[model samples]
Target chain A: MSVKNLEELNPIQIDVLREIGNIGSGNAATSLSGMLSNTIDIGVPVVKTLEYEEVVDFLGGPENVVIGLLIRLSGDIKGMMMYILQSSFANVVLNTFYGKQLDDILNVDEMDKSAISEIGNIMAGSYVNAIAGLTGLTIDISPPSFCVDMVGAILSVPAIEFAQVGDRVIFIDDNFKISNDEIKSNMILIPEMESLSLLFNKLGVEI
Target chain B: MSKVINVGIADLNVALAPDILATYALGSCVGICLFDKTKSIGGLAHIMLPLSTEAANPSENKRRYADTGIAELLALMKSKGANIQAVVAKIAGGAQMFATNSSVFNIGERNVNAVKKVLESYKIPIIAEQTGENYGRTVFFDSSTGLMQVKSASKNIIVV
Candidate 1:
């Protein structure tokens, strides 16, 4: 972990990060498509090194209710990963992931919860696997822990983590759309401050 | 005049009688509310970290940590003429949000413990609390009655 602030990343550096995201999210998207048996497409990720406070705005306001899947990345890099979907997407998730009847979004049973968590687990595994394969860094991810709560609350976990060391946070967001073009899920990867330097170093980008 | 003011993450605010101080989506963080029973003045702080040690050197925000945030909250209420000595606290939040064994950086527990220590050192008694669950909370502290109404994400509502 590098103990320095990244006020900005050069275009080349951003490009490198983008490629990393592209590879990782791309692999995850393929597996997700296979698991859901539906067409799932991911757009090019938007990478940003933002202030700790600014990151929560993308989650549709801190107070907006969201269903989130969280995991911890250990091994060579330590950080947090979250997959959040709007309630509007709950039916699709349940229909496609668990083959369960789509009813009221609020009627999520323990099985539905487990299914959502399993999806998160798979996505996390696929994401880290791709990053490791590309960067040659060892990555270990924990099982998915699920939560349904306010976006602000879910994001507070990472926000406070980065705030502890500094005010800068680096992350990538890949918007995934379902068959109908409605964005059903937002994939986020919060690489630790140290891990950013490690990745950049591997790419030969100076801090 | 019923007033409800929202305090953002790592922030603090104060209100007078018939007014309320509130904060939303507190997960793995602590909300400290101090009320002066005699003056009917209240202050609330949403602190994110346990100690200032974790704050970056030359910390620009003292209200973001428990050690500094609690003291600053008391000073703010006192500045408004609310006697710190007469202040009794009703605290909430400090939820884990997810189960993990890492007490080292288990920020929710740390924040809860830190807030308690700080308030104790200041000789303020904690009269009520709602904390340490795996759910986010929306808390409303009514200065008029020194009452805190807590609404959990899981749909549990209670007063403390």
Candidate 2:
């Protein structure tokens, strides 16, 4: 399917998109805060369209990259959600869960199955719910699968890449500050090409 | 005296003496072991990706991505008086954790391909490898005898 250029989107469509990101991110933050019982500080979500290379650059470096994927099916909306976290920030989240400091050493197996799942469940569930609320739709969410490592490995899927290329992607960039350290997370929203048109129509916003 | 060193994703630790080079829970990431038979020195690196060129600031962080970590591990071996050319390599890890109809994010496959390509380019012959499946793996390499073992859901401590 041909992808519509962002420039082709009307102002109302852009506003709707931004509002969706803000609501979804905010809801995710709230859910995480309650789950961890800590005052989770999430920066105001910013929406943007970026290339694959640009997303990698925004991740800063390898040391801090933790990728997680969640699939959600909300009524007529079925999509995959992905998030990236820096290593140091990941440690903080881990520490919060354990209620103590984790050894500087990370156990990849344990973290992937345990910490990553819990976090993904909280964030993805909340985010999907927010979207459903805004669109007056019900969405079913699948369990989150964690991928720790490079983005290339995690995003090598042809369909995922195609959807990304065929849509006006929205990125929610935010930082989590815990114990004097700043960690960044990017929430990538890639609506299916058809879904975007449907969403715009539903919102009464012309593309 | 021999000592064992274990590396994990996002973290790398070293043990200078002849011992086991171990890493657990390798999924979609490569575990690289470098052994110097003469010095009985060994190092293991669990690298997640092929390169750090995309990272904003690539440095000596051994636990982040693959390219930079491999270089750093080799340099560390060189500094310890281990002959680079004499070092033998055995690698493991890189498992697909999820099943997707669309091969969009088959990270396990990509990781294995990247590791093999990089090692070949570096002229490091991988004498043994255990990779690519839906299960997780735990790898152990003994520098003293150059014996690498892998433990997974399907297999138990099989020598590589």
Q: Which candidate is the best by lDDT?
A: 1
What 10-residue stretch in candidate 2 chain A is worst by lDDT?
Answer: A155-164
Candidate 1 has an lDDT of 0.79
After aligning candidate 1 to the native by TM-score, how far in Å is the CA of A25 from where it should be?
A: 2.7
Using all chains and alpha carbons, the TM-scores for the candidates as numbered come to 0.89, 0.55
- What is model 1's DockQ versus the real complex? 0.54
Instruction: Please list the residue runs of candidate 1 whose C-alpha ends up more than 4 Å from where it truly belongs after superposition.
Output: A1-3, A6-8, A101-107, B1-3, B53-58
Report, for every candidate in turn, its global Cα lDDT versus the true structure: 0.79, 0.64
Runs in model 2 lying further than 4 Å from the true structure: A1-11, A61-65, A72-74, A100-106, A158-164, A178-181, B1-160
Chain B TM-score of model 1, please?
Answer: 0.94
Instruction: Tell me candidate 1's interface RMSD.
Output: 2.0
